[model samples]
Target: MSSPPIITSSSFSSSNPFSSLPEDVIRAHIFPRLDGCSLASVGCVTPELHSLSSDHQLWSHICHSKWPSTTTSTLTHLISSFKGGSRSFFSLSTLPPNHNIPSPSPSLSALPDQIISAVDIFYRGKCIFSKVQATETVSGWFKCSPFRIDLVGPKEAVPTPISRPSHEDTCQNLYADLELSWIVVDPTGHKAVNVSSLLPVSVERHWLSGEVHILYATVVCGHVTCSVEVTCVGGGPGGLVLHVTEACLKMEDIDGAHLNGRDSLVVLQRVLEGKRGNLCSENRKMGKVEEGRKKYLEFLERRKERREKILRREGRLDNLCVMIGSFLFVGLFYLLCFY
Candidate 1:
């Protein structure tokens, strides 16, 4: 029996199939599959790849994928402000602000109407949920707090402690009515559950910077609850950054007794206590530790001032309450005697 000779096209048989394809084909077929990190690495390989990677359309997709809540107008404005266009903007958005890379300083005019907070929630050290949310200030008792808790969930009608703003106010400050939601995905069933209704238990301001820590806890499914604590920092001309400091999964048996919950709690405690790496190494490199110490002293002074203000306000409120009680007692005695 005779067999036909093996044949393979030289163009298709090459190890790098991307090189074989036309630039248009590569742009259309391959680039979309790459994320911002992958695109950056691939672009460095060759000038041709670099040119292909620099396309505005490619970077636009990457940016939108990373920050879906960003409006078209906002993206256009950001792209225009960056000298390197969308590619540069995407790189800046993904990379943590380090001294080595200059942070993008968009003019005030270019600031987006609504600031976007992109969050990635991890479970068991794996990314289970990621979403871009528009932050809104907490209202009522929490409004004046230095730290604000931004809530994000699935539905548009998620209840808020603060009343929705008036039309005029919302129009004037687009950031006022921005929606925040949290999308929690179950790793076991691979199903996504929106815990938008769950409110943060606490929001604390870090002393070092204007950063905030938000804690959220909710049950994703039966007998299982997940707790997520993230710190939002690094917002200026550059967008907001969220660092997931803690993610915990608690499980219970059918009888509602804790099952291995202590183990997970211990693991979470260890993780929280572990030392974190400094993102801004430039300060240390530039010998700015003295300047940082001064800043810390200023922070302490501010804390002292804030504490004094709070105590004075408390004193006033206590006096007002005592006066009100005394007046009520006098009125009651006079009424009884005269009657």
Candidate 2:
């Protein structure tokens, strides 16, 4: 058997694959299937395809398709407000958040007066909930209180196919499969950041209440952390199906205290500008998730070290105080005896 000649980008002699296809077919049928990175790669192939791939509609479609929650009117407006429109927003949300670099965070004014959160949750590939929530950051109460964005109202719950589990094994079996994407948009900064770990870092079922809490977390700046907690309760038809009653984002410092609104906004702004540390960047290697988990572990260690330092400093202070008190007592007794 004879070997066939290798097919290169120019192998077709006169016309390439892109040149042979009708532009409409590629634009309408083909380009939409490619994700942002794939679309960028396709653009690099040739000049003709590059033009088609550059279509704002295609990038916008990719954004909407990946995160359905962006279709809301408010979210749509925010997306349009991004510097390069949807393409810029998409790039911001998908890139790795390089969070641990040693640099001062931006001022609170970097945050918009109003911020938008587009959250999506999936269990077993089915979208359980998608919502866009607006939060007021300009108020005094927000600046002084603990920072939190509640995606679900207290009275309502989003029902799911998952049933309440009677045993611990059954309850935790689905933790690894849950997916979440939480993108926070600051319209004033013209930037957005994905604060979700893309998968559950931990899932717990309340022992007495039986409420399942699925937690997606990202370690911010090595010492700080951002987390989205989905609290699912049993409900729907005799309370058999799992109902997600609450979903919220919370930021915490090394002491585990909830970051106040002012502090939280600063961290958020830094996260928006930080470099995404993606050490495990191989395909199917759980890229960002693994990196997130690793950073979380490091954060724990740093927290421990901080506590130890504080304890050691306090111990030294306590010893010094005791020595001073004993010396004063001895000197007073000697003076009284001598007199």
Q: Clashes in each model (backbone N, CA, C under 3 Å)?
A: 6, 4
lDDT of 1 by residue, 1-339 (tens): 343222223323457454467878778877777766667666666677778878888887776665453335633554556567666555433322111112333333332222333444433333334444443322333223322223442222212122222223222221222222343211111222223212344456565554445544433222223344544444223323333333322333223334342332222222222222221222342233233223334444555676788899999999999999999999999999999
CA-lDDT, candidates in order: 0.42, 0.79
By summed lDDT, which 10 consecutive residues of candidate 1 come out lowest?
Answer: 184-193
Candidate 1 stretches with Cα past 4 Å from truth are: 1-18, 98-339
Candidate 2: global Cα-lDDT? Answer: 0.79
Best by TM-score: 2
lDDT top scorer: 2
Instruction: Show pairs that collide, candidate 2.
Output: 96-276, 97-276, 98-275, 98-276
Runs of candidate 2 exceeding 4 Å displacement: 1-18, 101-104, 107-109, 275-285, 319-339
Could you give candidate 2's per-residue lDDT for residues 176-211 as a string of tens digits? 667899998887777888999888878888888988
Candidate 1, residue 312: how far the Cα is off, in Å: 25
